[model samples]
Target: MSPDGLCAHRFRHTAITRLLRARVPLRSVQRYAGHSDPQTTLSYAQAFDADEAIADVEKLDY
Candidate 1:
């Protein structure tokens, strides 16, 4: 079950996002995600930016 509800697609999205955030190569993520097109894997990369931005901001201390 997903956080909100049971949805298999969410698992796919999360897995891809997590792999990207972990600095996994795009090709590896694509293969693991079973994506036929690199573009599909690239799309999941966007999900990681927000979290990365927050982490970067946290590193700054005023």
Candidate 2:
């Protein structure tokens, strides 16, 4: 039970993010997630950007 209550969408979001982070192909994730629009699945890419950006900054030699 989430503090915000049980919302199915939150689970969907978490699954999407996990799959993406695990390097699952976007098309495969779309099919697995049952999203009719590829664009909708692509939207999850933004969620990973912040983490990736942080990792990039950490890798800076300076």
lDDT of 1 by residue, 1-62 (tens): 76779799888888888987887776677789897766677778785566664464354333
Candidate 2: residue 19 Cα off by (Å): 0.2
Candidate 1: clashing pairs of residues:
none
Error of 1 at 27 (Å): 0.3
Task: For residues 1-62, write the lDDT of model 2, one tens digit per residue.
Answer: 67869788888888997887887766678789898866677677775676653553354343
lDDT to native, each model: 0.72, 0.72
lDDT of 1 at 3: 75
List the candidate 2 regions with Cα displacement exceeding 4 Å.
Answer: 1-6, 49-62
CA-only RMSD, every prediction: 9.8, 9.1
Tell how far residue 48 is off in model 2, in angstroms: 3.9
Q: Assess candidate 2 and give its lDDT.
A: 0.72
Q: What is the TM-score of each candidate against the true structure?
A: 0.63, 0.62
Query: Model 2 clash pairs?
Result: none
